[model samples]
Target: MPRLPRADRAADAALLAGLTVADPQAAAAFVRRFQGAVYGLALSITRDPGLAEDVSQEAFVKAWRAASTYDVRRASVLTWLLTITRNTAIDAVRSRRPVPMGAELLDQLIEDSLRSPDLAESAVHRLETERAIAHLHHLSPDQARAVVLAVIGGCTAAEVSQREHIPLGTAKTRIRDGLRRLRAAYAGGDLEVDHG
Candidate 1:
């Protein structure tokens, strides 16, 4: 391991001592020693001089507040300060991102999703579909058959009724029960279903 310079170690010791006691002189000295590198790291991350300055200031304020938590065993003073600057700069960039969608947008998204079968074939939705299919194993065979026919096979309840040679009500009941059971498997937890 490369050794820290003796003079740098001595300066670190003095700066740490000052920061630990919230000494203004020590804080100033610490800033004077480390400001260039901190600002540079923040600027590189934020890509804006003004934002870099803000991030640097926030990083310094955070460092000052969290000074007592600093441990030389964990990192050198410069390493810790740069970490703070990088994180603060990242947060500044994130803060400038577009605002989150509202509840109306969420509802519209859900409605669009329901009308789009191809959307359900996307990779993420395919994984969710596989998970839902796995959960179908927890259902009774008759119920599972009803759900597969109605949901996967895209059959109406009457078609399921005709195909399964069961009454319309029986087909509907099987689909509803299967759906409710799967819903429970997701929303609740494991259930003891004795199909005997």
Candidate 2:
């Protein structure tokens, strides 16, 4: 799906805020606006329509709970929602007991193969991801470490600082600085940007 531009994103933020205030029709409008993306992400992760529906509902519930903390400056609404969906799905997957390697692993392997037909294609994707990660390395070591923990490991900045034995402000600075460098690298043509 194509991404919404900045204007649409701001409009979405406003819509969500209105919904939070319990506008009679705001909830319907909010669902109409985001349901497709939410369901699509859930389906992608869960691979089951029923499970996706459940996860989508749960994600929206979580989003509603966290509405007051939504910061448009940090991430778009869609990104934030999808992050919640993805984390929830990952948690769901992890919660399941490990099964024998036969059917499940084989299915996953087949899915991965179908997703990337050839080693070259997979390699290219990996290379691009690595290059983006390398741009993080251009930051100061502490900053790079914080960014890595938050972005790559999916930890919050506070978690990153705790894990790294650093102050919270330091962690925030590192993450912010690292992200700045990453954006600069992308804008300066030093890093290839992939919209996907």
Candidate 3:
């Protein structure tokens, strides 16, 4: 999306200033101008349409609440909106935990794979795995760790719960939510993969 021009910036600043003095229309216009960019950024980071929508709404609400603190000297309105989106997404990711997997099952799979060829195909697989890991990091630390354990560690929901010290249901939900976000991020072109 094109950045708002300087002239528009001045107008927006003026509108925001008016809003501080109780101009409802100016506040409405401010929301109309920046809501799309905020939602887009949230969607890019969270990867769930519903979650993105909620985050977008929350971000705007935050902007409205914090409008008095907005200093045009520090950054553009869009920049401030995006910062709120990013922080909101990160917060959403952190509060949730991941489901656990069976340690014995994972060990069995590893043992079973020991006889498989560790050749060019394995190298390619490793590279793809690394790319997935990189994408996973875009999530909040809790989500990322849960996703890594579920995808890479091959842990079951119960196992993840035990390891993370969270309830089984919470673990499961986090793993499911993380996977959903991962798929959304990959499909939305927010994440790049190295096929080779």
- Which candidate wins on TM-score? 2
Model 2 worst lDDT run, 10 consecutive residues: 109-118
Model 3, residue 82: distance off in Å is 1.0
lDDT winner between 1 and 3, please give it. 1
* Candidate 2 lDDT tens digits, 30-60: 6767787778667756677998898889888
TM-score of each: 0.45, 0.51, 0.45
Measured with C-alpha atoms, the lDDT of residue 36 in candidate 2 is 78
The candidate that achieves the highest lDDT relative to the unseen native structure: 1
Clash totals for all models, in order? Answer: 0, 0, 8
Clashing pairs in 3: 98-171, 99-171, 100-156, 100-157, 100-160, 101-155, 101-156, 102-156
For candidate 1, lDDT tens digit of each residue in 76-189? 677677767767876676577554333343334334323333442444334444555567766776787777666534457886787779999999999998877766776556
CA displacement after TM-score superposition, residue 88 of candidate 1 (Å): 0.6
Candidate-wise lDDT, in order? 0.68, 0.64, 0.63
Residue pairs whose backbone atoms clash in candidate 2:
none
